[model samples]
Target: MLKERVINETVPIQKIYDEEIMKAHFSSETLPSVPLVYKIQPGSNQARKNLTPTLPSSSSFDIPDAYQSTNSDETFLIYDKLVSCKKRVLIFASPK
Candidate 1:
């Protein structure tokens, strides 16, 4: 006589549906509401003094001879040279 063979196998898996679960847990009607308000105080009449003291009203302000230069006219000349040079490239970078 021939004997029959039998096989049994099982595989288990768990999946989480985040959107459906969140939708069931949270709703607009269940959330709490709070009112927000802000108020500003009035300033006092006392005048604030500068941290760095200013020069006397009678004294005339003058730039130091060493720091002054005729570079203002040369700025356009340098710009023109940069424009003429095809190999040159200008790039400006700023955080803002």
Candidate 2:
């Protein structure tokens, strides 16, 4: 059934220089002065793996406390709704 919605998609590919200039901090010397090339690809899984290291620091591991509601019944209700939707959500990356 899901096969009917399997449409093709195009994604851009980029190769950043100074990828390893420094892993801890960014300095003026390490920053790029101008925009770099933006290559397009038919599709590739490598981009998904390569992107983990490039995300901003704020999104790496921070979690909000509000999402952890104390009421068990409310949590179960939310879980039931999510299951009933029957949607396959492929979250490639999430904010930390």
**Deviation from native of the Cα of residue 38 in model 1, angstroms:** 43
Per-residue lDDT of candidate 1, residues 1-96 (tens digit): 000000111111011122223445655665333111111101111111222245535323333322232323222212212344334333322223
Runs off by more than 4 Å, candidate 2? 1-23, 33-96
- Per-residue accuracy of model 2 over 1-96 as CA lDDT, tens digit each: 111111211222332222322343566865664333332222233544443344435323323333323323233113211223343222222222
Error of 1 at 9 (Å): 58
TM-score of 1: 0.12
Winner by lDDT: 2
Total clashing pairs for each candidate: 0, 2
CA lDDT for candidate 1: 0.24
RMSD of each: 29.8, 16.0
**Residue 25 in candidate 2, Cα distance off native in Å:** 1.4
Per-residue lDDT for 8 in model 1? Answer: 11
